[model samples]
Target chain A: MSDIRFQCIKVEQLDDIHVVRFADDKVMDPARIEQLGGELQRLSDSSESPKVIINFSDVKFFSSAAINKLIVLEKRVRAKGGRMRLTNLRPEVRDLFGFTQLDSLFSIHDQQSDAVVELTTK
Target chain B: MPADADWIWKIDQEIPSRAEVACGLIRDFVEKLEDAGWNEALVFAIHMALEESIMNAIKHGNANDESKLVRIVAGFTASLFQATVTDEGEGFNPADVADPTLDENLEITSGRGVMLIRQFMDDVEYSQGGRKILMRKHRG
Candidate 1:
């Protein structure tokens, strides 16, 4: 586990892949979302070639602002030659990704194990 | 575009340009939709659309100015949902928004709200120089 603590996310290290899970079931609050985004960005910035996997198993709902934050996080990770993936999206949340065409923009997996395998093999 | 009487439930209020207050209003509406027997998927779609619309009004349209207010008018029936959100700020041009789905814009953090609203809602129209947005969804 990483020493960094985040109010909105819980991070666990699996070799080089950091699997992150959100603390809130609803990622709709703007202030919290901003804080969450800041934390994720910091994680990406502080790490060397970070490999991240965001697990959405607990998140029931989120707004576009949250999606915006994820996009920003993705870019930040990629800019540093890191990789980020998402997993365990509920059908509704996955539909939002499809609606925004973001499903194509990010590497998404059905399970954390799958993402771990993909990231580890890459 | 049916008569106002067609709606079984309606809400009209001017709220402060605050995210919490706006989201609270959306939650109330979602609860109402649930009480009215809208299925989970439809409720989720409506909730997402309302969330984006109101947030855009408060964050972008009103610029989070406490003095500015966001006007929301929403009506719903078992089969239909309709809403109009207007903000007290200089309106923007929706057409000028870059397509977030485009390769170059995909990394951009903003500008996806409008597209999501349009995607989830069956019908959406912008007027009053983009200060006001009208959205409608039909339960399927």
Candidate 2:
């Protein structure tokens, strides 16, 4: 029912938890990141759903600008009294987070189903 | 430092310091690296490092001035990948960037591009008075 159109992300909802799938397998610059930031901002402002899940199964390469958008989105969701989790990270993406030590900051799950189950259960 | 590459394709091109142009160049560069036989992870590393360096060249270095230019040069061999990005602006000292691991800078995302580039690439060097950046990654 959402009229919102995101250039880089597909949105779906399960109960109160909103799931977002990144459309591109690789992003080389900030254009997609900026678009994603706008979409995530809209999601945060929506009263329909609070909990969030981000699925990254299709994404492989990204810049820190994308990660910056993620941090901003995380803060926005927290400010809106909800939480977010990341799922389906490729090994390289996982290693990127490990190198940055951001793996300690966000809740990461192995698969989209697992993330949904956990977020919906909690 | 790059070893003697078996086959190297060099790109000496200039962009008008536009973000969209930069993105297109990055994508083309990524495809070129893949065609050079780099595995996914190594290509990803190169892609990440390239984006940071080129973005810095366009954004921070050129101050987003369309009149400025960003130059990119990159090539790869079977085992090694090397790239350089140069900008037309006053360069800043890389040493001035705070350690993102520090408590105060951990949440600040803007400063982490340089750090991430350093983290993913095997060797990263800044020269040309810091307006130019060189990044290399070795494949296993």
Q: Each candidate's interface RMSD, rounded to one decimal?
A: 1.1, 1.3
Measured against the true structure, the TM-scores of the candidates, in listed sequence, are 0.92, 0.93
Best by lDDT: 1
Give a tens-digit lDDT track for model 2, residues B1-140: 45544646667799998999988888887888888788888888888888888888989999999999998888777777788899999999999988877766667877888888998888988998899998888889
Task: Provide per-model DockQ scores.
Answer: 0.74, 0.74
DockQ of 1: 0.74
Q: Which lDDT tens digits does candidate 2 get at residues A56-118? A: 888888678888888888878877778899999999998877777777777899898988888
Q: Go through the candidates in order and give each one's C-alpha lDDT.
A: 0.88, 0.83
Clash list (residue pairs), candidate 2:
none
lDDT of 1 by residue, A1-122 (tens): 35677899888888777888999987888999989989988888768788999999998788888988898888888988999999999898999888778888988898988988888887
lDDT of predicted model 1: 0.88
In model 1, the Cα lDDT at residue A46 comes to: 67
